[model samples]
Target: MFERYLAALEYPSQGGINIDDPKEFRNIVLWLEDQKIRHYTIEDRANLRKTGSATDWDPAYAKYKIDLGFPANLKSKTEELTWLFLYAIKLEYSDNADRYRSITAAQKIEQEKKSSAAPEIKSTNPFDKLDFTSPDFEEGSRKLAEKLGIAYHPDHLVSLRAASYVISTALNKEVLKEPIITGKPFPIDEGIGMGFENHQDLEKAARILRLLQIQNLRKLQTAINETIVAVQNITADPRTDTSLGKVGMK
Candidate 1:
């Protein structure tokens, strides 16, 4: 996928730049490519050619390319290449989804059983407290719905699902111990088969992150309470600490 993205950018396959190196840089590649595809449309092809957002595209790609001794020129082919990249990404996602679905029902059941035996630390999603009606969230939800080709009525369940995807992805990146963004993109088709795999993976990650956070807090609170109780008991003791005094005096 990274190589395909590089090819779309007209980057050389043989060069000093290792396209698969230094995990952080690889993550940036994934994030950029995902953002581009999520925003792609048939209507924007003309606009892309006529006027492009170099401000949007240049700095990140150029930084990596320069080190590899490639020219930083990406403006002219931006539209053509973007379309190709989106096509490739969507195709690969479909292939992966098909492969994933081929697993037997028994295997899935066993896997679920194993997962269920694990301890669960339940917590309310921080997103539950958020004001979804805020302008920033509303605008984000709209863009997300448009990206996923979901109908965008504010009151609709589909819109809420889209909002959850956006929120979960953000939380998984920012809050999780192993951030999901540094990992792979969602694994299924975004539009037609969204809820089956792609959206499910993201939501599961988000739930794990929220639970981990709540569990950690509970542990910390327990430790603190224990420490306070110990201190109070020591303070209330009528006897002086003979062992400590003996050691200090000696």
Candidate 2:
């Protein structure tokens, strides 16, 4: 019966259409237009729209949800699916749809249990270790964050001084601590109070940063030397007229 209804409506038999896929979902709009199913209330819209294009569903979806004693928002996908199952019944998709409803309910209950059992741990700082030298470097990070479903802030330092606290805390915990003598120390130790799980990891990261800095310095020095050498070569050329600057002699 469900299959028959979907066939009659020309709705896709396969399910799980993501709301974000605009190209694949334009078909739903066409189908609704063909049926002349316009001006649907939010409730009805939720029913027909199912997974995409809020405007495509009938407003009755809202009412269907209300009838089932669930909230209108249906925040979670499972919650929305439960409402969709009820909406399917309202559409006469199946005469004996209790089995489907039961399955959906079980799935919803399982989802709720899992969410309750293990709540996700939130990150304290989202943009940690995010550093950049150029604007392009930061832009690349922002693009990557979007693809990875992470929040990006145009916030991170490029200088080694900005990361000094991290390196100091990890490598020189003793220097950051109070003097063992217990007397007033001449220099107050500056520490961010963060500890490393493995000092070796911290050392490795610091080493890599140092190596990169050294490599960059070497490249800059080489470029500077090459420029100086080129200038010397030009000044020493015998074919050059000193005042006229490299005039070809007849």
Candidate 3:
């Protein structure tokens, strides 16, 4: 029934339809709300070994809230509907539905779980080996010296290297703290201390990295969408391909 509604919305196409039309969007939202309420009521009653009825399901409705552990109860039908609507919109707007779905689903689950995990911090000594010629090595040393208002030395350089490693590790750990679809940490390469030859080169590198990251995210979304489609037995229509191209889905 959910998939049928999604199909009615003509999802899986680029910019498939404008949900900005308040009346129509609201109608769709209401329909989704009804569906969710009915589904939840049925599931809850079955779990409790009770004869499920509208009145009997009232107690099952609860506000969604994040706790230290366990998924939150669904707060309201509106929230569930909103999520479904946004998901469909995202899928239609972005070519990479799979990645979006995976990330979104993981986030939703994490929100419910109220994850208490903290990032792991790693520290290292930088001065054991010296490679001052490399921009990354030199820049790290220079930044540390400037920040500390101290003269540069081999020992200082080593300390700076260690600091850089620590900072990079902390950042990566934070990213990993987020729940992932695979329930495994993402593989991050060794931290490269920032040391570009010039500002232009730095800007270019940043831009390239951003683009690559976006593409990677898109790929992930696409994979997730494919998985969902397969599980739901949704087949890709040839018309969807043409429609996607028309809306610049690439």
Candidate 4:
């Protein structure tokens, strides 16, 4: 998908994509996402340019002589391309939902099994105390999320929120196992248990981070639910009545 985006830029449209109109030049090729998230079909995704984003970009796509399924009602190249972007992300969200469901279901099972044991009071989400009253946090978080291309519209916040918590909680689990020393210690079985420093600061840090993690994890679940609902609200296929791009780009 991104290769097509780069290819679109190669043809010079919309002043070409404004990478610096945003931030950091990270390679968008992310095969490193969670193993559960994957291509929805066997289709060559890089060649997934189903519609042109600009009349100029049409030539670039035409140079390759590829054809895309014209989106429903969008006639302009830009509109079709924009719709394509939404569709692509929708596909991504769909895949992520699957992964999220599986992970959560497994977690639920684990929790059920553990429920028979003594109850463990878990940390509250630190994110709950965030200063949402001030516009700074929401504004900054939204912009940063957009810059990082995580959550763009409010609808996408669900997946973004969930993913963030999953990361924090997973990290906190490791941090809670503290007395962490950089260097390898002698085997405990050999009576050489030494050099592990238990800092009060780490204990506090772990608590804060854990709280934040738990908070976000629940938010993430909410986000996922909202996203599923949002998807349900799309009643029309935008490309349904659309015509294809006009052939001449001169």
lDDT of 2: 0.53
User: What is the C-alpha lDDT profile of model 4 across 210-246, one tens digit per residue?
Assistant: 6669788999999999998885564343543235433
- Quote model 2's TM-score: 0.22
lDDT of each: 0.55, 0.53, 0.51, 0.48
Per-prediction tally of clashes: 0, 13, 12, 10
Report the backbone clash tally of model 3.
12
* Superposition error at 71 for model 4 (Å): 2.0
- Candidate 1 clashing pairs, residues 3+ apart or interchain: none
Weakest 10 consecutive residues of candidate 3 by summed lDDT: 61-70
Task: Name the regions of candidate 2 deviating beyond 4 angstroms.
Answer: 1-141, 146-198, 244-250
Estimate candidate 2's RMSD in Å: 20.8
TM-score per prediction, in order, is 0.19, 0.22, 0.16, 0.19
- RMSD versus native structure for model 4: 31.9
